[model samples]
Target: MSSVKERFLRYVQVETTSCEANECCPSTPGQKVLGEMLVKEMQAMGVSGARMDEHGYVYGFIPAKGKTDAPAIGLIAHMDTSDAVPGKTVPQVIEHYDGGVIRLKNGVEISGFSFLESLKGQDLIVTSGDSVLGADDKAGVAEIMTLCEKMLAPDAPDHGKICVAFTPDEEIGRGADLFDIPGFGAEFAYTVDGGALGELEYECFNAASCKVTVKGVNIHPGSAKNQMINASLVAMEFAGMLPPWERPEHTEGYEGFYHLMEMSGNEEAAELKYILRDHDIRKLDARKQMMNTACEVLNKKYGDGTVLVELRDSYRNMKEIVEQHPEILERAKAAFLANGVEPIVKAIRGGTDGAQLSFRGLPCPNLSTGGYNFHGRKELVPVQAMEKMTEVLVTLVSVK
Candidate 1:
């Protein structure tokens, strides 16, 4: 059987960075490439029906070991890496770390912080200094794949049918947008896409994307006077209207924040993009209303057409949906404990595909793949963690 770490290394070698610039499904062609690769791998592993959909989603089926009443379970992970940094480079596996400051190519160094102590005797998969390690969800993908391989063995333990799905464009928050829950044929699912070891998340932030546009009159500086409205200044003023203390850097746990993602403009026009998040639906609504109010007050000062804000709901907290079926959580906790890993339950400060899936009637929750410092060059995963998580996935799908 191929180790989960080896499978993860193979998966990350494919460049699957999702693009926000593209409005198309899957976001980038690289995502399709990875999905196709996964489908082939699954088919080679005996999932003859495995296939990649037109939208770049890959699905595979594992029939029950014997006819039984156990509910079919689904395991999900994203195929795409984050677009925040370059993600084409394959990872370098550092074997049996001494926990010192490990140096990489291009003069980049991986800081051996106190966290390194935990993995002192284990192998580590790290970046080569030029790109992200792609362990964010790829590790999750590998773990699920390894589980499939194990479960497919002739002498494997008896289990219920299992569904496996690999999605694209998760980095851009569209992972669950095109997901076919009914077709997946699972009573409930779990997304293997959290950080650190043993992290479990059922609650996630209620999310929204906001775009504020400012229309300003541009005139000659000498003749500008009261006739000219600086769009850049107006955009800054609009940002200023938000509470300074409430931002991603300042908030934690259940706190809500308004993140100013991007702003670009000339005096004639300007646009600001923001992502608002809160753990509570009521607070999320209030945050959106606050953004609208900010625009309203600014428009009142600068004229009716000067400021315009557009707010769109993205996803909601999954706690309510997840609560309805307590067995999912209980089973997951049992799996973790069975693998000798302690479960750490926490609310995700950001949203996941599981959050949207839960809302879509899947009652999905998030689980960790034992990766840390994701979406950047410093991303790394321990070999032991991947092995343990693979065991957890096997336990999760097996009939108890």
Candidate 2:
């Protein structure tokens, strides 16, 4: 059976970046490739019913060594990597970290933070600065797989029925879109996709995808004067209208932001895509209204049909649902403490598959994979944390 680190390294080599441009179920074929690999590996570990569904979701079953009266726990992690930075790259393994400024290569360093102080003396896996290390979910995947391998051992500990799922297109926000929650059959689940070693999160931002379109009349450059209304300029102006202090970089700790995700077009037409987020539902609604208001003001400046704003809700805070089932969090915290890790219960600034899964009646929460700097070239994971997390999963599923 492969170790967590080995599985992580091998899996990261596969390019599984889920494309937002694609409308397909997976949005990328590499997700299917990784899904197949997960199935084969699980089957090799003597797990039953390990198979990838038609839409590229992988599911497997692990029967308890002895039957007990405990909820069937599901362990889930996404199979797709973010398209933010190139997530398809081999990681540079550091056997031991001295922990100062970890320079991957010339002019590239993972420094300027106090977080590295804790990683000293631990084994670290990092990217070469050209691409992301893919630890965001792959580390979670490895931990779950390693946990399965241990559960199948001759002297394996007792656990209730185990359900494992690997989803695709999580980065594109469709990971739970095609999810077959009923068939998976877990009373509750935990997504092992989070940063740091001990993060246990249930609350996530109320998310919405915003699209702003600007249309303009164009004329000859020489005849342009006031006749040619520049759409791109108007789009920029609309962006300027939003509070500049209310962006991702300027905010933290329950502070919401209007993140401009994408913007493009010429003077004749332009489109700006943003993701609006807030922890409070009222504030989330206000943020949406703010966008619509901006569009209204811009339309008055140009014309009635000049600017258009479209908003789509992605996910909501899982706190309300997860709070109803507090035992899951209690169990996770106990498991973390048992494994010599502190449980860092915090609210997620971003949404997870757990946020959606919880609202879908799974009462899901997120666990940390001991990874950091997700969705960027600076991504890395601690070796020992992954191992501990694997143990944590074991204890979480183990019937006392």
Candidate 3:
């Protein structure tokens, strides 16, 4: 059996960074490359019907061996890494970590995070400080693949039908957009894409994308007195209208925030992209209202067509949907406890593919891949955590 660490190392070397600029499914060609690789790997592991769809989604199933009556369960993870950093990573494996300041290439140091102290004596896969480690969902992919390999063994315990899927463009928030729920053929599913060990989540933020465009007249500084309306300054003013403390860096838990993701412009026209998130639908609406009010306030001062705001709903909190089926959460908690890992039930401060899948009638919840500091240069995953999660999935899918 191939270890999860080995599988993860092999998978992360493929550059699968999803681009938001691309409108097509998968977002990047590298995603399709990874999907093809996963499909081949699944087929080699004796997975039935292993294939990659045109949209770069890889799907396969393992039929019940001993227990044919149990409900079919699906395991999902995204194949693409975040576009925030480069995806072509050089992973460094640290054997028996001493729990100190570990330095990487390019003067990047992994320290100050309290979670590191708990990982002492365990092996870890970290980045070389040049690119993201791609552990966000690839670690989940590796664990799921390992689970399939184990469950398909001749001496393996009895399990229900196991359906596995690897999606693309999850980093761009389109992972569940093209999902084939009915064709997936699972009563319920779990997205193995959370952070830290034993982190299980059902609730996520109600998300929306906000774009503010400022149109202003630009004139030479020598001749400009009152005629020159700086669009960049107007954009800054619009940003300032938002609560200073309400941001991703400031808030935690259920608290919502408006995160300004991108801003670019000169004097004639400026654009600011923000993501609004809140667990409460009512609060999320209020945040949208606040943005509209800000636009109105700015337009009333400048002109009618000076400021324009566009708001689009992204995903909703999955708590209401997942709570309807308590057995899902109960069964997951049991699986975690069976593996001697204490389950940490918490609301995700950010959204996941499971949030959208739950509303699509899958009742999907998020599971931990034991990776931390994702989407950046310092991302790392513990070898022990991945092994334990593989065991958890085995117990999760096995029939009594």
Per-prediction TM-score to the true structure, in the order listed: 0.97, 0.98, 0.99
- Tens-place lDDT per residue, model 1, 306-388, is 99999998888899999899999999999999989999999987878998899888989999999988888888999899999
Consecutive 10-residue window with the lowest summed lDDT within model 2:
105-114
lDDT of 3 by residue, 303-377 (tens): 998999999999999999999999989999999999899999999998888989999899999999999999899
Alpha-carbon lDDT of model 3? 0.93
Ranking by lDDT: 3, 2, 1
Off by over 4 Å in 1: 112-114
**Per model, how many backbone clashes are there?**
0, 0, 0
Error of 2 at 75 (Å): 0.5
* lDDT for each candidate structure: 0.89, 0.91, 0.93
Hey, what RMSD does candidate 2 come out at?
1.0
Please, what are the lDDT tens digits per residue for candidate 2 over residues 1-400?
A: 6788899989999999999999998899999999999999988889889999999999998986786777799999999999998766868888779988888853578897778988899999998888878998999999999999998999888888899999999998999998889888799999999999899999999999999999988888899997999999999999999999999999999999999989999989999999999999999999999999999998998889999999999999999999999899999999999988899999999988988888888989999999998998888899998998999999999987
- Give candidate 3's root-mean-square deviation (CA, Å): 0.8
Give the C-alpha miss distance for residue 264 in model 2, angstroms: 1.2
Give the number of the best model, judged by TM-score: 3
Candidate 3, superposed: residue stretches over 4 Å from native: none
